[model samples]
Target: MKKPIYRTKDEELAQIFSSKVLPRLRRLEFFGIIMAAIVLLVVILGVLALTVFRFKVPDIKLRAVTIDNYSNLSGTLTRFNLTLREEIVLKNQNFGEFKYDKSEAILSYGGKTIGEEEISSGCIELTYTKLVVVLIEPKFEGLGSNQNLGGGTNSGILTFNSYIKLSGKVNLMMISIKKRTREMNCTLKISLVRQAIQDYYCH
Candidate 1:
């Protein structure tokens, strides 16, 4: 047999594999391995989103909203699941897969609650903000007046302020992406006027 290779105590080792210098590979438990993998994946994804993707979200806006079938009731609420359609503009600052699950519209007059409605559930995929419509129900039928939902009714030329709240999640569209994080919904608001229609909502 050839002589075994050996080095002096102070010999310079070109390819030295000293036990102290070797990487310590402990016998990993299943849970530990899984946890490590998840952590590694998260760190990589976070770096990607922060660096290559540079994905981000901005506030949403209600460009144009209209109350349809406003004149159906003859001086009272016509009670037909009244529809309020709106045009929204979303601008995505970063490259990301954005989506929406639930949306809402809250209408308040002069800083008092008027109505809060649930528009719909949907998904939007992209970095750029697009216009989306929300249909909400006041959940109550009433007369030619404004009323705060969960509050009570107030009347016309009233201070009309509205808030749109959203809930959803997003995915990073990349090969390196493994674990996706839940994204909070982007939302916006619009100030509007609700003129007393000749027709109204009556219970």
Candidate 2:
């Protein structure tokens, strides 16, 4: 060439901007986008953990069982009647609220249903305990010569069993996320002398 070319400062700066600054800026933008996507994924996983993956069935227990009434404790016991009262305790240890439907508590003897009662529908708050009362009236029949009855009455003790089941849904974030069922079975021994429940076991 005849002479050396001259470049302006502005041109030099423009060339630097296009070659270095622009690519660096694009890389920063891409990094920001990836970071944003990761954050969004974490939030979604947290929400699922609290509302769906951590769900569990409510805990149910029989707090107490007692005999409210009986017919003629001291007699031939050809035919007898019994009235029982039960205290059911519901414990909720979840982050969501539980709302159950109407259900039943049944009383049985010798694999036979002798009495039953209705339990009203209700709700249990998170980490709270609820108490429900149920009444059962059992009618004894055809026990004139049954060995269990004859032996129990003569020995001054009577045995019975009770069952309860509850079905409901867990409510969280204004949505019913899961459905659960809980149940309890108990065997009780009644002392004729005390005219009350003496011992019991439940599962």
Candidate 3:
């Protein structure tokens, strides 16, 4: 006859711990590692999204145009000169500063250039609007018999067109990047009787 082997209570308890509790603890540790990895990935994606959005290209727009002053509407239409002072609002909607070079605004009547004004170079801060004023002195010449001028003078109104372009770069995080251009074309009408702008729009 063979006798069965016997174990102590402490040994049985140790065996149960190794077989059951050890495996459960290992599974918990693996799940914790996976959860931590997922959380870290989510955080990295979030930071990338924020960085891309913050440093994206800027949007520049011409918000408004106004005729501040006009002169020399009291003489013969073909022999008179008109000096125009116009105000334009340059709006920058971005998280960076825009630095533009010196540019000029051109005035045209009857498809011919008549006057020009120089715009000084400057910087526009993030999410702000800059007001720029330019003065153009238009000389009436070479269009002695244009029917449009005659009609406009008879109706006490004058129509003109203006164009401006600003080329610049965006400064983000103290570094300049991304060359951009902003342009505006405006058609305006001035009432001779009121010496004021009748209508104006820019594109």
Q: What is the lDDT of residue 82 in candidate 3?
A: 52
**Per-residue error at 106 for model 1, in Å?**
1.9
**What Cα-based lDDT does every candidate model obtain?**
0.49, 0.83, 0.75
TM value for model 1:
0.44
Give the alpha carbon lDDT tens digit for every residue of 109-159 in model 2.
778777789999999998789999998987665333434465787776878
Which 10-residue span in candidate 2 carries the lowest summed lDDT?
A: 141-150
- True-structure Cα RMSD, model 1: 11.9
Per-residue lDDT for 1-203 in model 3, tens only? 89987999998889877877889988999999999999999999898668633543334344554444455544644334456777677776666888888999999987888788899999889877788878887766656543347688778788899998888877877888777787788888977767677888777
**Model 1 poorest 10 in a row by lDDT:** 150-159
Record all residue pairs in model 3 with backbone atoms less than 3 Å apart, i.e. clashing: none
Which runs in model 3 stand beyond 4 Å of their true positions? Answer: 1-78, 142-148
- Cα RMSD of all models vs. native, in order, equals 11.9, 4.2, 5.0
Please estimate how well model 2 matches the true structure, expressed as its whole-model Cα lDDT: 0.83
Candidate 1 wrongly placed segments (more than 4 Å): 1-51, 72-83, 110-112, 137-156, 174-203
Error of 2 at 81 (Å): 3.6
